[model samples]
Structures are given as C-alpha cells and as structure tokens.
Target: MTGEPILEVRGLCVDYGLGEQAVRAVTDATLTLHRGEVLGLAGESGSGKSTLAYALTRLLRAPGVITGGEVRFHGRDGSLDLLDADAAALRRVRWSRISVVFQSAMHALNPVARIDAQLTDALRAHRPELSAAQRTERAAELLRMVGISADRLRSHPHELSGGMRQRVMIAMALALDPEIVIMDEPTTALDVVTQREILTELMRLKDELGFAVVFITHDLSLLVELADTIAIMYAGRLVERGPARALFERPLHPYTAGLLDSFPPLHGARVRMEGIPGSPPALTALPPGCAFHPRCPSARERCRVDQPPTAAPAPAPAAATAAPAAADGERTAACWLIDADRETPARPARTPGSTP
Candidate 1:
C-alpha cells in the first residue's frame, strides 16, 4: 500500500569539486518515503548510496556540493524545502523532526559518558521544559522500549556489547519520536545472528513507533526480507526501484538481477553465486552510456552509446508477482532493455574495423 509521502526527493544531484574535475556522486535520485514505510537503498560502496543520504540531510561537508535538486520534508501542517532552509531552520528540524543512526554505534556513542546521560542529552536540549527527574525517567523508559534493561543505562559505551550499543543508538534516534529515521548501514560490523536480531527488533520498533525508515546498505538479500520497497543504485543513479518482492522475483534491469545473484539462495536448488563482474566506474571518468554496461552481461550496442531516461520506468511483468498493485506502484528501471520498442529501433552498429 503506497501511503502519503513523508519525504519527497526530486531530481537530486551532488558533485565533488569544481569545474572539469568534478565527480558526480549522486545524479537524479528521485524517490518518496511513505509514512511509516521502510525504503531500502542498496548499491556498491562507491555507488553514491551514502552520499545521497548525507546530502539529503545537509550533512555533507566541504568539497561535497549539492549542485541541484529539491528535498521536501512534509508534515501534517505543511512542507519545508530542506535544501533551501537556513541553518537556524535546519537546526530546528534536525534531530527533532528527522534523526539519523550512523553506520557504527560505537563511534556515534560517547565513549566516556554513561548511557543514561547520553540518552537524555537530546531530550534536555530540545525539551528543556522537562525537569531533570522527568528526563531521567524518560531515558529509562526508552531503553526498556528497545528491549534493554533500565539498569544498563548506568553503564558506559565500553561496557555494553556490540548489539547493545546498536540498540542504544536506536533508542537515541527515537528519543524525540521523529517522523523519519535514516539508518546508514546500522548493522555493518555485527555478526550474522546479531544482525538478524537487530533488524528484527528494529522492524518491530518501527511498526510500534510508526516512524518511516530509510535503510541503506549493500545487502540485497537481507533487504528482500526486511524492506517493503527496494531501490538499486549504480554509479550515482538509481537503476531500478519497485516493491521488494516483485523486484526480487523478477528484476527489470541486468544490474538488479546481478545483485540478487550475488547472494546465495537460502532455499531451492543449489547453484554457484555469479557475482557482478568488474568494478563500479569511477565517478570522475564514467563510461559514456549506461555506467553498468561494462559489467552487464546483457548489454547491447545501444547500451554503450546512449544514457537511458530516468522517467521511463517499464512495469514488471504481471505474471511474475502476486502483488500487482505494489509492482505497479512506481516500478522503474534506467535501462534500454526495459523498453521493447527502443530495443530494436536503434540503427545498426558501425563495425569497429570496417570502413563506413
């Protein structure tokens, strides 16, 4: 079910550096996070996945310039353009309206401070009206909500396990009950079992708290089970996006299919994992046409000559998925193979060695 848009990003673009040497980190990233929905963002390390998230929150530092785009944050009252908001306005909205959970909780958490002091810091800052006792009580309750015993609130970061540290970070992110939460690789260094437990708990908390989440990572397999919608990014642009199950069952783009194959199947006949070949293109010197053509097994002559339009999204085949409505809900891919007419209409390719 496509709910109302809580955050709408349109034609976003980000570049690093000035003039000729500029590297386009994120190009034309457009997506909407539905209210209380989980939108998964997956891509290679250098594919501009994290860059898009950081830029959207205006967390990018120098050399990372937001060349173009619009990031609108919607509330029940009205919408605010985050890109144009002044520092004062942004300070007012950030943490209170939209919070972030970084990749590593250890680094995000204060090493010296007790969990009790750390958790209540946000509440003390924005919510100054509450007394000290009230803030302490609220902090303890938040820890309990995330399945942690309130007694652990007295422990320092070094005393907690990796999983517990992550839970603390989650609790802090929800301190203000934000409408949206951006989690960037929140389970990176944890063990497989720990990762699964954390994701499961996070999903439960999301359902109970009613906050939209932007879960970014390179694990398509994990996302297939946890996410409601999945979007694949390659080289700085979104190549395919749709319902998680539909995209998993029948991917429209070759790159998307390759990512799905990268992970071993949990069931069904056993087969070798044929990971995507070659590395992602360098942003400063990207390929002429589609960025993924070099490693794409199904690439054609046209794929090497022209870039595909971001607007023309081919609907997934109806027979492949049971959720036709979700499949029809904004499924799109930036690949020439998706367009049936465009596939055969291109002129014959010129021979490399033969004279014209």
Candidate 2:
C-alpha cells in the first residue's frame, strides 16, 4: 500500500544543550517513511517522540541541537539532505513539500487572526504566483475540504470550537498540497468522539491526497488503528519497528508488550493489567547499558552491563500465531532478550504473561 521511500532518517541524535551539560534526548534514531504510508511514532511522555519529529524537520529550537544524523527527503524533483539543507532550500520544501500540523491547534493557530488569513499566509509566501483573489478562493476551498464551512474562514481561532480549530490547522497544513504531513498529537486535546471524527477525516484525506504522515503520539492503541507502520521509542531510542498489526498482536519487545498491556482491549474479556513498573531513566543520567534496563521486566545481567544493538529479530516459530509475524528484515527490535532467545532456539521469547 505504501510507495517508494520519501523520507529517510539515519543515526539521528539530538541534544538539549552543549557538551558536558548536554542531555541526549534522541540517540541513533532511524526510520524510513514511504510515500502515502502512515508511520506512527509512539512512546510515553518525555520519550523523545516530539524531539525526533522536530529534529528531523529542522524545527528544533535553540538549546536543542541535532548532534548527529542524516535526514534525506526525496521529492519528485530529486533528493535533498534536509539536515544540511540551507534556509532557502528548506523554505522551498516546507509547505509545498513537507508540512507540519503541531500538537495543539488552539496554541498553534494565531488567536487574533482569522482562519482565512492564517491559511493564506503560506500560500502568500510559497505560492506568490497566485493573485489575491485566487489565494482567497483557495483558502475557502481548503476550509471546505476539511468539512468546515467556507464562511468560517472569516472566523477567528478563539471563536471556533476546539475540533473546528483543529480542522483548520489540518486545512492549513494541506493548503499547499504537500507530499508529507507530520502530525504531533493533533487530536490529544479533543474529546473521544471528536478525536475519532478528526482521525477518520485525516485517513480519508490521506486516501484522496496520497501524502505520507509521521504521526507522533503516546497513545499506542490509537496508532494501532491509524498507522500502517508503527515505531516504538523508549528513553529516546527506538525499541521496536514493524507492521502495526504485528506489533499490536505480538509485540517482540517487553517494553512494547507492557505498553500494549496498559491499554485494555476493546473486544476481549476484561483482565487485570500490570503496566511497566518504573519510570523512564533521566536522559542526563541513563543507566550503564540499556536505558530501559532499570524498568524492563525481562532485563538480564547482560542487559544491565551491555547495550544491545538494534537488529532484526529471529522469525517466530511456525506454530506461533497470535498475529502474522513481520517478514524477515521487515521488523527490528533492540533487546538483549531477543538475542538470548535467538541463541537458544528451544527457549521461547517472553510475552506479556510468560515467565521472564
């Protein structure tokens, strides 16, 4: 369903400050987003989900720096290294090629400005060829595309409902018809029903527009339904990446299993759930080996002393069938437990209720 690679991130590292005092917020984070696919980035609060998003987009503010990484954005024209792209190149690509719908629409939108003016701002900047009347017409069309009345385009952000404002933000992001849209918790502030509406609208729009999405959220359950691919991050590092259904029904990493357990199933019998035991490690004072060792239920001595490299996990046994296992080379996990299990074929990988 997904097309060719559109955005590729490799060995991306982000720091919060200068050397000696710096906190590594994201370390060696890597993922590829294919055209027209929805890649969900999920983790608990302060897990670097947003940091990775901003860093890759070159939107990280002062005091936060991209210490290391390569962000290659492949457009229809050609490929460009986003991490090294100059201001002019970035401007040419931002709205017209890659757009961002930030976390909260209420805060992202200008409270004083009318929706039409705000929507047309990007068109004015990136699309100067359009006349004043043309830009206004396009703005009105965008509002209607997102299901908001064109008349509401004259309304101010404060005058609109939260859901309406969020829709307007989405409209602005789509105004230029960008190839990629990065949404950071776009529905976090809306009510459950409204959230579903917005998400359904988003998917429908994606189907019609064919733009790739990097959706960042802490809600694993939501991602399960919305994303084609899911990437799980813990302590600033990606712990797992695979097909959404595979990750949801048969999480290969203990951390992933813990996250899935935290959310009760919608159709299954109720069962007591024990979430991950401890807090995430401080970025400035991470443990010696794996940052997750302190909290991983299946952590071993080696896990406390030796960091595990990210690698493709061994294929699931033929008899195992909770969900379809990710094909070879299609799934990867960072966990010493996976390595241990691979070494001993007789030993089964630990699951949610299995003895660790």
Off by over 4 Å in 1: 312-326, 340-356
Candidate 1 structure quality by residue, lDDT tens digits, 90-132: 8878888899998899798989999999999999989999999
lDDT of candidate 2?
A: 0.86
Worst 10 residues of 1 by lDDT: 347-356
Of the candidates shown, which would achieve the greatest TM-score relative to the real structure? 2
> What 10-residue stretch in candidate 2 is worst by lDDT?
347-356
- In the order shown, the candidates' Cα RMSDs to the true structure are 7.5, 3.9
What lDDT score goes with residue 302 in model 1?
Answer: 84
* TM-score of each candidate structure, all chains considered together: 0.92, 0.94
Segments in model 2 whose C-alpha atoms lie over 4 Å from true places: 325-329, 339-356
lDDT of each: 0.85, 0.86
